[model samples]
Target: MMSDVLKNCHHRWKTLNQRWSLQTRLLYINMLLVGLMALGISVAYYTLTRYDKKQQSRERLNIAFKIMQDDFQERL
Candidate 1:
């Protein structure tokens, strides 16, 4: 099964290789690499921003809790 898959891929690659020129293949490869890099960067940025938001929310909650504790202590 694995050999069959490899044979199919080789056949498709040969067909595509014959259809496109060397320069066109290089350009296509470059565009694919750049697109992949952009996607990776965007994912990283999204993850970092989400983490920062969570940290900020936690900090705000802690501050509010401190204030409430102080108020309760003063009343008692």
Candidate 2:
């Protein structure tokens, strides 16, 4: 089943190659690759930014808890 699909895809690619010049095909393929790469990079950057924000929030909470503990100790 997979082989049939692959063969069909190959046949279509060959048909396209015959219709379009090689340079045009390569240019389109390159553009697709660059667009995918840009999308990946943007996703990675957003993930990292979210992670950094979470880490900062956790650190701030830890500091607040530590300050409260110090106050309790001083009162005791």
Candidate 3:
């Protein structure tokens, strides 16, 4: 009787182990996806910020050039 009980217990343990391993794999896959998403978002944010700064710099440079042109014309 004891041997039969031990066999049943062993079988149950094997089933539980398989389920645990599957769950662990799924968790790892989910973590990887989340990491990728975070990286993509970070890159996009940086690009947008850089573009905005470039636009502002261009506007400032144009204004400065216009001022210089006007000043030179007045002197002439």
Q: Which candidate should be chosen as best, given TM-score against the real structure? A: 1
Worst 10-residue lDDT window for candidate 3 reads 16-25
lDDT for position 26 in model 1: 95
lDDT for position 51 in model 1: 100
lDDT of 1 by residue, 37-59 (tens): 99999999999999999999999
Tell me which of candidates 2 and 3 scores higher on lDDT.
2
lDDT of 1: 0.99
Candidate with best lDDT? 1
Candidate 2 RMSD to the correct structure: 2.8
Model 2 scores worst on lDDT over the 10 consecutive residues at 16-25
Error of 1 at 49 (Å): 0.5
Q: Return model 3's CA RMSD, one decimal.
A: 10.5
lDDT digits (tens) for residues 1-76 of candidate 3 = 9999999999999887787877797898999999999999999999999999999999999999999999999999
Across 1-76, the per-residue lDDT of candidate 2 in tens digits comes to 9999999999999898899997998999999999999999999999999999999999999999999999999999
Question: What does the lDDT come to for candidate 3?
Answer: 0.96
Better TM-score candidate (2, 3): 2
- What are the models' TM-scores? 0.83, 0.73, 0.68
- Residue 44, candidate 1: C-alpha displacement in angstroms: 0.8
